[model samples]
Target chain A: MKTKKSLLFISYEEARHICDKIQYGEATRMEQIKLFIRISWCNISRKYTQKNTQLTTLCQSANLKSLDKDKKDSLKKMLESKMSESKD
Target chain B: MSSNTLDPTQWIDKYADYLYNYSVSRVSDNEIAQDLVQETFLAALKSSENYKGDASERTWLISILKRKIIDYYRKINSKKGKAEVRMSYNSDGDGDGDWMEERISDPHGNNAEEKIQNTELGLAIHECISKLPPKQAKIFSMKTIEGYETETICNELDITPSNLWVIIHRARTALTACLEENWF
Candidate 1:
């Protein structure tokens, strides 16, 4: 009779074969899930970085366009106030 | 970001489909899988500074995504506090008890050879992996499916070497048992 450990080891090899199928996209649901996650990640990351860059550019441009030093200072002060409020 | 910067965009084209398919295999939900992928990308972008180029960009991005998925489950489970309740399969209109019975059926019997042939063994294995305990399943997928090294897996999971091995061993054992009973 085969030892229990040997039986388990054989079973593990079988399981690994099944997993190999999944890794290779031979599995249906597994393939779908992997595809969905990848697309979602790409979409989200691209959008987030794009949005952040746009916001940063807008901030910079607004700051640069301000001719009045007093207005620029006030804008900085407002940003500081908002930052402090967020901390609170 | 500078226009001259090498866009990781090329990486997305090559790895996005593969990665998304991998995530979807684990989560079994399209929307959530998509969200996880997006989170992975956003993480890569934010932490692009920390990526030391030791691993391929694909590997690094996947590591981040895996962490995000774990965090999501942790948050959800904390609020639910009822693991048993979530274990059942009710949302698909199939009774949980019946589903469990089906899940436990052997697919590789002499008469069931056709079923095994028609139904891809890989898909069956994917389902079996999905049924594993949450942490074990994640660890197994990261190691077995994603091909991450033990050291990287431990670091990403914040687990000790022993803990990682234990989880992997258990996960493999459980999957094997489940497959033997249900498929082979």
Candidate 2:
């Protein structure tokens, strides 16, 4: 009884977190298997996993890019100076 | 009911990715896009008084950025012997963004049609991301859009791996729900 309960004990939040890790290619094989088992029985987990994968695929296709930290830092400094100059 | 506020200190942190994506879609040049984002911030600061708290700051910044992009083209047009044809897009016209986008070739293995669609889809994704709570938006952009390593994000944000994962999960839930109406 204890073993069975332990096997099925994963919370939905935990399962969803694992889903996120899997999407990012960060989940370990053991973690992957745990998620696989959870999704096998939990309809909510399965649905979330599907939507999560679809979201990743869509973002991947979108080819989004981020402004790096160095540029962002420079922009911030520029804005600071401009703000001060405007006030003066 | 409109209740939005502007905070310049938070601008770079919150809206930089959003504006970067916005400008990249229009300009199609990475360095130029980053410069435009910077200019957008400076311009917004100069005209900060014009913001009446009605529109969200992101919307207002985007509006300003749109004008700046147009001006960028005008500047280039005059520099190139003033004979360069200025391309304009009819937002509602059937021909698509005929003038500008039709000219720039995408080097990222995307054909023109796919590039245009991806731009729209990218903007839509950013729009949904912009609606997330600030931390979640930042985390999602860094991890997913920026493609930062998990450890790097954890170190920068001072979050544990599990904390980041929780935030990612919540952000994904919101993003998926948001995107489902227009995309799936």
Candidate 3:
């Protein structure tokens, strides 16, 4: 049985590092457990995780506008012409 | 059905908006997005013979566009000199990752505040990413924004997993600092 004294409480640096590994799915099971234990009580690390999640979601959902019709038509003409040139 | 094959001419009208939106979201540059979509069309035409009709034309085009975007990142990074990836920690020499503590705080707010904040938050994030040193920006985008797997990123950028972790850590910390200065 793992003794309470032997259950290593990680440092802030280690906890953040493991949090990153967890984000990338790179942490080992034991590392994940340690990270979870750390974040459960560590408000700072929990905030880090929340910010990381927010950043990832913001990036994934970045709403970018599309080209207008006139621009699309011109680009299509250019590409089609280039296609024909390459074919010949 | 008048035709069994997808008409190539109709691709722009049918899929240009989709391709543009996808490209712009990833790259966040209108000209590059337009160029990438055009390149996708050209590549599709070049590889038209490879189309077996198993996937719809739109799917095939998207696949090509995705590859094009990856290639664009690879090509741009290739032109810069290959520097060894190094860890950027606090200059105080503690290596504790404590440099970010002063700069970042909880950005959370009431729902109305969040709604008002998120628009500029998006622009701030993009601006902060663009401010990273070129290689870090590229690697960060590939790993975080583009969602490339870690191993693939390591192989493509010729860095180890540990090195990537350090770079990503630095990038995120830098972004937090930037966001604090600009957004918060």
Candidate 4:
């Protein structure tokens, strides 16, 4: 049981590091279990784990669309002129 | 003659939206994304003579855009007020230990309300990152947003793994506290 206990239990600081590694897909299964066990009792670490996951997900889906037609046109015209100037 | 010399004017109609979306995702600023996309086109024109047509026009434009984005981060890092911004964060006593004040339960992450909240939090998170010391911000985004491997980041940024971890932990702590203030 000594091995099991050491494998599952970890300090908060260690738990946080494992949590980050888990998110980054760098943690081993043993480390992931340790982090899960730690977060079960550690509210702060649990929140941190949740927030970190949310932040990454948000960023991946942060595809903000550009809808400024006028700006697009002006930029196009400016680029065209610049290109022509370079040619001449 | 080879048809390799792609016309510059066609880029706007063909790739502006794609390029703009890419830039905004990286930089998280609409105005700056627009400017960068435009700049990408200009760079393409300046280097037009180098178009050997081995790559597609879109591919060439994207290469130019990627360089522009790197330059944008470098420019921000070299800006004058970087030290002032870093000093604004409380770096005196216990490092980021003070940021661990309170923690709430995990919110349900996939419901409609949560999705809406994420949209708002996306902007807030970007703002939080921008407020960090420019170096921390750059490294954090490179790690998280760009998903660079740890060794690659350490080597490219010329930082040790421990140094990278410290910066990331601090950045995450500050961002958590900031998002809680603004969103939670």
Candidate 5:
């Protein structure tokens, strides 16, 4: 009778081989699944990152537009003050 | 946008095959694997400014792909109404009869060697891998199958070294058990 340890060792070796077969394309279904997951992941991340950049850009533009509006308001106030002082 | 400016398409042409092979090795599905690779390239191109060269371009792409895989599984399992179960073998328990019997039966049988030699072994492995819990399978495939160094795997997976080792050990043990039950 084989010891439990020996049996475990054999099983592990077999498992590694099984894993290798899948890795090397010896199994079609497994290969397909692997590919599918990878492709899906790549696509999802790509879209996610793209959206992130767009969002950032939008936020930056909004900030810039607000800043510009503030600048224009300040200029108008300065001109009004000078006109009032000259009229007085 | 210049005519000669390296674009996503050019990068795809250069790295698609490699990325495809790499993704296939992990997820084992052709269309999905290709999609992942394509997406990686697209993401890289869109976020090119974020590329700090801290990692190789390929490595950065793979890291993104890995995150995508995790998200996919999370979405899948959640949809199926199955709560993810995390199990660990204590390695000190009295060997369970079912586990021992499983080891003996070698469900894939002695013919496993022949199966391993067959080209379809890749597919079989992929199927088995898919059956694995998402994290375990990812770590196992990335480390053992993809031949990534442990440190790199840790970085890509965003896990600490100790956590990485623990996960790998659990993954290998689980895979071993799985093979015994299914592939023999």
Candidate 6:
């Protein structure tokens, strides 16, 4: 039996995009509902959602903080000048 | 010989954040952490020729960073001298003891086991991030780790919101897959 195509249904690709958005809290309520429905019976989408959720949890608990842009830029410039000086 | 080499100029571009995160977790100070990363890069540069391909570039740099961190602690300890603790007895024979705060667990210090776990997790995430395409890596880092706004990232990267989303989706998928094996 084939699952009928309907306007209300979302494709697995869109479901994945929505899953990514949901990770960042950017997914709208409607998108979340659609994703919820899609993965309810879709095995592939469900597996993707499970892994995506696990990834989000790992990132949150990692407690990682990146250096700001200014620091990174200055560090790069300092290394560049040092490298050039070494060659000379 | 295994094939691994150092690129001095890409040191900051590639490993600055990774090294910074590792050092900050250990040193618990941002300024000192940044200094250690810079010193590690410079030291690596001075000894670039001596680098054989036995270890990956990141691993070799980390070895140097570990030394820098240890040296930092040693210098501070030498400057301050060995810690002296004095447990005093009250002259009137009342209760007196060592520093009261030292007797208590530090609330702000965070639990040691959890901190160690987070540090390891953070390092793993950074390692995977390093393996991503340059643009994808930058966008993902800015959006996810640094928590930049979508519009802000788009304008900075000169890409539209949709394009940003596409890159993020790809990067996230790739990152999750990579981490699943190494981390989970």
The iRMS of the candidates, in order, is 22.7, 1.2, 8.2, 7.9, 24.2, 1.1
Per-residue lDDT tens digits of candidate 6, residues B67-134? Answer: 99999999998976777757653455443454464457676676877878989999999999888887
Query: Candidate 4, after superposition: displacement of residue B21 in Å?
Result: 7.5
Question: Could you give candidate 5's per-residue lDDT for residues B1-184 as a string of tens digits?
Answer: 2222333323332334345555665575766665565556555555666766667555676677777667766777788786667756555566665665755676666665553343233433444554566677666666655456767878877998667666665655555555446553
Candidate 4 lDDT over A1-88, as tens digits, reads 9987876789888887877776678889888878888888999989889988876565666533433557767987898678678669
All models: lDDT?
0.54, 0.87, 0.73, 0.74, 0.50, 0.87
Give per-residue CA lDDT, model 1, range A20-54, as digits (tens).
Answer: 33433343664444433443446543343343333
TM-scores of chain A in all candidate models = 0.27, 0.87, 0.56, 0.62, 0.27, 0.90
| Segments of candidate 4 deviating more than 4 angstroms | A1-4, A63-88, B1-121
Q: Can you write out model 2's per-residue Cα lDDT over B1-184, one digit (the tens) per residue? A: 6588789988988788889998988888999999899889988998998889898898899999999999999998778875666866557667665656656756566587888898889888988887889999989888897789989999998999878888887898899989997665
Highest DockQ, which number? 2
Give the C-alpha miss distance for residue A49 in model 2, angstroms.
Answer: 0.5
Model 5 chain A is weakest, by summed lDDT over 10 consecutive residues, at A59-68
What is the per-residue lDDT of model 4 for residues B1-184, given as tens digits with 9 covering 90 to 100? 5565686766665566567766776787888998899788877888888899988777788889999999999998888546665425556666665444413333454565665565555556665665677678766766776677889999987999878877888888787778778766
DockQ per candidate: 0.02, 0.76, 0.15, 0.21, 0.01, 0.70
RMSD in angstroms between candidate 3 and the native structure over all alpha carbons:
21.1
Error of 5 at A23 (Å): 23
lDDT of 1 by residue, B29-145 (tens): 766766676666656665667767677655676788789889878888897886556454555765545775677777665645643342344444555655677678667666655
Candidate 3 Cα outliers beyond 4 Å, as residue runs: A1-8, A63-88, B1-32, B36-121
- As a whole number from 0 to 100, the lDDT of residue B98 in candidate 1 is 75
Screening candidate 6 with a backbone cut-off below 3 angstroms (N, C-alpha, C), the clashing residue pairs are none
Provide chain B's TM-score, model 5. 0.43
TM-score of 1: 0.33
lDDT of 6 at B83: 75
Question: Poorest 10 consecutive residues of model 3 chain A by lDDT?
Answer: A60-69
